[model samples]
Target: MVTDKQNISVNVVDYPYDTSVPLLDNEQFFYIRDEKRHKGRGLAAILTQPPSVQYRTLAERVKNQSKYGFPSHKLVLLIHGHQSFKNALYQPLLADKLSQEGYYVLRIDFRGLGDSEDCWDPKLGRTIKQDVEDLTTIYEFVSSEACKLLLGRTLTLDTIVAHSRGVISMFEFAREVYVPNLINCCGRFDSHGLLLKAARRSPTWEADGGFYCHTLRFGEWQDVWIPKAETLSAGTLDSSKFKEIDSGTWVLSVYTATDPIIPITAAAGYSNLFAGRHTLNIVPNCDHNFYGLPDDPNKLNLSLRKGKVNYGVYLVKELVEYLKEENQLERFYKTHQLIKSAKNEGDVRNRWCLPYEFSQISNFRDVGGYTTGSGTQVRPGIMYRCANPNEATAGALDYMKSDLSVNKIFDLRATNEAIEGGIIPEFDVENLSFNNNMTLSPEEMAKHYQGMFLSSYNFPQAYEIVLENSLPTIRHIFEYVLDGNVDEKHAIVFHCTAGKDRTGILGMLILGIAGVDVDTISHDYELTTLGLCTEKRLIAKINGRGDKFYTILGPKGREIAAAYGVTPTEMAANVLSSKYEAMRLFIDSFLSKFGSFDRFFYEQLKFNKIEVEKIKFHLTI
Candidate 1:
């Protein structure tokens, strides 16, 4: 949709922010009353284009999601300033504009503002610190399982557009957690500036606890009693100590040219603070609220038009341009790319598969972005596969904990294959190992892997053994989806040591079940070797270790390795892969027996009709 000025206009639907659903006359949008009262703050939120979702139960919602393709792949979080929310402010327009740009907007209402619950305390309500806490809580909630389940699709905070005082809280949030792209508009930083502005603006300001301010709303002035000792406690927010977003974060700071409450000169030096990709854009001829009326020295005796055209649209367009930047789009899709391209350390860092130098984990990929042959795509962030979580680097562990949110791991390694780093992860794990007793001698194991060419039947026999033995466990894993608790099982990572053989077989099954074409599945399986090659390159380069690290140790190294049927190249491939033909033939053999995946689920796995329906409902688009 486009506004009169051809400004992009995005439509929004209100969905559940909290656990409860709101009453709505229009099913497209929901109106959640801001009645949540917490520690001196209240909150509410609007979910834009929440997959056109309106259902009473989680199953119904998810089924509906499969029926209606979720078109918007991006999610944006819009946080309001000091005393604002969506409606009765310019934030709705901003949210809609972002929606028009294919971003799902979660417009937040801070406590004690808009239609949200009221805060009785002055210092505690909407203070920078408290607001920062609110931001963290809201972000966590938004990126959580319940929130994703409600939307019937996975969502991440792509860009955060904050106005006025919300920017300070966002800055604090940027330090506490990752803020993808932060757009700060007319934000006041530093404690002295805010208190000085407060004192100057409020009529009944006092040095003591009792201060009357018009902050609660425009028409009413309210008294907030902060004790003399605690009066300036939260008022002094220092941005000097904040961390730089230089490490692959995008920051854009905008200010109104004529913002009376926040001087343009105050933000003039702000751009110099960031060492990363940062832009400072000042919207000309606007006030702090941008489109809202400005406090002009020239308008002493004049009355004005209510709102002709929101001069604010110009300011909001800046946000759209920033959002539309290629870097931002890459940042958005990088999460969904299962097989990452190792172009550089910077590009590697932006993706989910962290390099081996920083990642003990190998072949880590969330299996959510596979596009089915029928056109719908598997949602990202839920299904995942990686090398044993037990072998993950500290950075990789943190990534899994904070970003990937892998709560359950299914170990597909044999007892010996998973040794030191084989203990269950921090979260729950089911020790479902296949090929547990395939104890060929070292020479025989090497030959078994080395002699398996693309046309060789040994490859298919190998994976068929895996499929035959692992069917029961795999059935349990999928059936667990319908066990009534989807929250604790948000992301399920199944893996062996290299995450290639057993893990790849399972990945093929998952992709095949999701209706991704066999060709895509073959390529996805092929990525294991590429990903492991990246690991090998990293291992070779780390600490001045060169290619010799991956090659024979000496003249006898090749002879010794070869006697065990393990040359350097074959040795590396042995650990990382067999071939896609292994899975292809294994699946072809399965088809020869069971006929179809549906039949295999019924005959081999013994899933009843209802269970089969549940599997189709959960896995398919």
Candidate 2:
């Protein structure tokens, strides 16, 4: 078992202050000598005199110490990666962000790299263990300084947050020592192959045999490495073994699909490793170091970078929430759970406008009580729908880029809608627009019901064409899903504008492919009327309109269908068709022209097989 000495083992040292000229953000450089070693300590820096404004920049800013209930008003050490400590630009943004969130952050110069002295141990070969020991000393020194600043008041080291190699060191110290909390940003494993990948990309650790090497270790159980190999080895670490670890510690592991080195799939696996209390978060396209990288021109390189997405600013906010929640330092607000009143079960309507600026328009939500044929309810977050995220808020965009962690976005909007919207942000957004609506606008098709005249325009050619057009996009959505990205463990959201029309069509298709009855699909589609617009106002508008005008007309499907020769019987089939096989048939017939759906999705839409599977699972089981 690792010792609690990790948290309490740091030595106090009088670090030198870098009185060098300040940087763009008023950041100043400083260093601390190894009080025990009595040598020149490596480079250290702090972003001082930051804008003294709060979250929204209120008139009077509150004092940092009193405002945030950290037992004291001082900073703890911050540890940076091999390259960042020396280079001002490469420093992990998490440190400054955390400092802004109230905790004083330290960007430490790890032993043997950056501003620190070279290693004394030869076996480890510039490993993170020495850095862990250094951090312990830093933590102890900071804790003592904080206590002294408080005039004999006592306080504990509240938390340690690390990224990349630094994350490994933090984990090592936490496992061996006693610390209240740890947050791992892009934690890595101990596999040589994976380590090489990170090393190739990392500007700092590339020369030292990549990140980690996997040497065989003997044990009574399965291949037992250093037990804490994950913290020791960058490539060969296995988080699966964490369940056996027992410590009074709280761990938060955040990952993004776009992370270049760390596979997004490994985030949950690593988080699940710890038996102790934990939280695992996945951001869509973040890189191994948590910085959003620029897109690569080559397709393979682009695919690799797709998981390294980034969110602007809000990561600090999350850390703030995490600190408060874990320490019970802030009041928690329970979301309102009042039972909504509705005229009937079908009348239920709920809309959750997400908190980010760029929420996936393709990601819509479903209530938990919608029962399946087997009498089981569809789980919330399991499946979702939304409009094209061409206009997602910055906050919403960040949430999707850094939180939702979805594998694919199925788009059914016509080519024109997409071209008008411009190319969706390439790094975080995937385009899968396929539909058979060749007739450009509602104006062009006003006189004829392409699918069903009036009630069900039986225009098989137009219907088949439109449906076939959608096949390519849906194919890609499902291909990526089946590739195992969207298993039950992950949630997916699909959508279009007004939560009806294209969005509704996709929703109904999913339900139909899943064996949900027609009434449920229609009811689900109709729920948008309530969720998006006020009924009284809509009714008033319809009543005020002349008899020649239909309320559901003018770009609305119901209106277009009413104007066509659609019959009640055909309408019921479109609205109420429920078997999975039936919906599959409809999709298959449409895709027949474009080859299989898988071909359309993978070959045409550019999504991998994993992305497709995620969407397919929604239809299967």
Candidate 3:
């Protein structure tokens, strides 16, 4: 129902420049004010009116003021490239679009460009180092109390969207500042390529120390001095500097496939360096400035033109989607109270209802205290799910043995997985690998599952495959409980690498057999999203195995991946996410075919009525 209408008001303001930085006197930036009010309608107005007329309004206001209230206002900073003003290319359009989306958008003109004061120092020019200093000055001013008073609201500078040469300065600024999100539009990766192009244009410039080149600035052509110092400063940049950026910063590199300026291969350099934290989006049939091909039928040129197909819209689209995800993640963290839980051990255990907290372990929690359909509760301290305990501290192992009385462990990993991630040597562990009873050879099975785990869209299908092949493992686990091996006195813990996918399936089977509803089972699986160690392991696995799976896809696989608009690492992160819908869909499909959990146990798992009764008796109280 939302239309692309300019409903927000933008204000242009000038803040005093940082006196510490030389040759910068005044700086100017534009910020869009979000007019949407957060507080409820006045209570005095409601009470002054008759109850019948104002009751609905009061109820609506009350509903709006609940725990999930209005989203916090976020500030987005847009940086322009060299020889470009703040309004160049997509900057103005993007700023308006983001403002319409309820964000406080700031589009700044770096010194020596646009409406800002010029830096005419002959020796300094507009070097990358100077740009970084300019950025720092602006960043510090924004974070100051004076700026907050001017805005009338406290804001967080969460995202930075930069174009071309500005991307280099953005990353350089990130070396010290910790902005959560960054967008790179057509950023050049090869500094040597830039220097070579400049050299070809001005052959005698290096010999003469500097040369004047014609550049388009503010709708006019002017001869700007291209200094040798600026070129050398840019040439000194390399991928090693990218490593200094925070590892937690999420990066989005958006490039046009047919860019006339920077080669498309520069996109790969960013994806390679940022690996787990990067997303690459290549818009097709667009130029360096996001202009599309001309609408003429016979036109074969790929240069920027006033075409009907505007690719800058696509660039803004990608930026909006990435920002939406980041905002959702921030909301999720706040809703789940994970900000405090991630810091304090006591808070994590108390808030998440965890009975024990381990310094070296993660996603460890008891699967209990849920009332089943028949009014019986699943007893606490009897069964648990956790990540691999290979790295559990010695004190944690002893605590598990003595305080928790965990006597048995069922590792649900494959043999190769176990070899790669070793086991806990303290417990009486059984390797109930999920790959058992599969008819395919190990090589074929690996290929089959690897392809399935490549994308989150295929996760439900992968769960079905795991269910079909893991019958023997399921039967072994149930028979162990049926044989009076595990009891209330001695608990059991079952796990995989991150205790999410495979462990989730096992937890589903156990709870389903205990007469727990599907919704509860799915929600229990969703709790893995809050695990601290799960995210860390996801990053590690993506960096380690992302390329291997991509290469295994071959040519046809790559074509399919490109069609989906995702890179290999992005797909890997998707696969590892603990989405509630995936588990719910898997359960829905299983119930559709088998009718009920009882029937599934009798037919697929080959458990008799007596054994099923024992499972229920042992799992619930």
Candidate 4:
């Protein structure tokens, strides 16, 4: 038993088994938050010393504690398996290890198992329901104001590590409660397997009311009772509950390939169920307890077995690495103030080219304030560029419609793309299918543009193809804008998927026709990169490319990659970039071909001089 110098009342209870470990300096008693308090109803927990207090002498540690308080603000809960205590297997080692890395580690023994209260009855034994209740009580106590008053400092519950049966309880708790990180070690996926194995082992045990088995308790064999109620409860546990675990929780499931108790397929089951937010790791040559097989002395060579190796080391290694990565990411976000910046819209607004802030939109801004050659500025609030506004929140959509006075939206995506990305239902949207002739169906146009993009060497070539093919759409847009329909009170928004490639081309044309310089046009194109920093559509596009480019280029893809010293994925990411040089090159090539925007509009788009002058007159102040 341990005492706090602050004279906090701690009701210490002795365990059923002996816990004479050398690492008992951090032991403490926490009363279970149970209203019906029977005798011996409490929790036995070990709070490991963090790095700042671990190496200090007793006097120095007490002095430092008196002055500066607890070292860690992050708390990690370590839960043991069925028929196990707080210090079983890797719990103690992992607790100390994680504490040394600046986390407050709490290893607790569940009720009726180790040093906790004996609430286990022969009829109602230790059920999964009971385990879940125990875990909830402990979690509540640790997170409550009562615990804070005792500790003298608040600790945020960061991660939970559970083994075997405790994994079930942890995941069940996660159905309603939220924890940032979860680690599962040697956990069974289905309860049916446990029932089947038990039926085979003890066929008449249920008929006999209960069975007595010799199980390891703190490294010693002890007579343990396996009641009928326990078996029935374990058998009735629904594995579907795992799927109901919170999606935001990051899960890391670790299993050994050679584990006798739990099959390897359990890992795959968790991987499939968790899908996006879980990682599965399988350690080699280990058992359920992560103990390695002893080398066979009868064999000439010791090739098949690892001689008494503790594979628990590998488990701890994976845990440490995963926790370290999570800690580093948390620290990085805190240090860079990204969370605060994301919340404070002003910071993100000032970092970009324009001052528009839409709740559910990215790269949505007014394309205004560009000075033409004649000193007249392209009028602001009349034109905008953005990614798809389909997912924009109601408030953001209202802000766009009422606050910004947006009246029209020119969607430069293919017909299929428009249907797939959806449109702002509140706006009058025109699907400017930029394919030649506009005769192809939505799907055909989508495939056609995809082929063109995949075939082009760089964005400049792609932009040229788009400009050439989309002449009809371009003519319609320019004519519509100049047809006395748009004014300062009403604005128009144009976008493709990311408001980068096709959208950039259209922006260049409008700004150029408004007499904006080539450098400003190029800068406007480059701003798309910053605009898309928070956008996932660009990432989806890059990932969606997959091996299509590799397959298309075949041997030439390798040659090109070798020439540029980049991988296929890198090449794909480059194709998705909105670089200044790419737009500048496209503009230079266009001017070289048609001499000026006037000739290009007249020759390519067949726009008359009156129409061009009307476009210039309407877009500029």
> lDDT values of the candidates?
0.57, 0.45, 0.65, 0.68
Model 4: per-residue lDDT, tens digit, 1-621? Answer: 222333222444443454556454554535443543324546666677575555343324323432323254567899988778787777877876776665678888776666666655657777777777766665565545555556654455668999998888888888866566888898889877877777787888768876666645433668878787887777778878777764446788999888888999989888888876778898777678877655413222212223556666667767877777334343222222211122223532122223335466677766765667676767666788987778887787787778678889999889887898788787899888665435654554444343333322245555766777898899899888878777757888899888887888889999998898675577567666666776776677776876665544444555544443445566566656665545766776787788899888889888899988888888877
lDDT of 1 by residue, 286-386 (tens): 56776535454322222233543355666666677777634454443432353222222232222255566677666766665555656565555567776
lDDT of 1: 0.57
Q: List runs of model 3 lying over 4 Å from the truth.
A: 1-71, 213-221, 294-308, 325-621
Off by over 4 Å in 2: 1-29, 34-39, 42-77, 86-97, 121-125, 145-155, 193-246, 291-312, 325-621
Deviation in Å, model 1, residue 546 alpha carbon: 46
Give the better candidate number (2 or 4) by lDDT: 4
TM-scores for every predicted model: 0.46, 0.38, 0.46, 0.50
Clashing pairs in 3: none
- Cα deviation in Å at residue 192, candidate 1? 1.5
Ranking by lDDT: 4, 3, 1, 2
How far off is residue 361 in model 2, in Å? 48
Choose the strongest candidate by TM-score. Answer: 4
Q: What is the lDDT of residue 178 in candidate 2?
A: 49
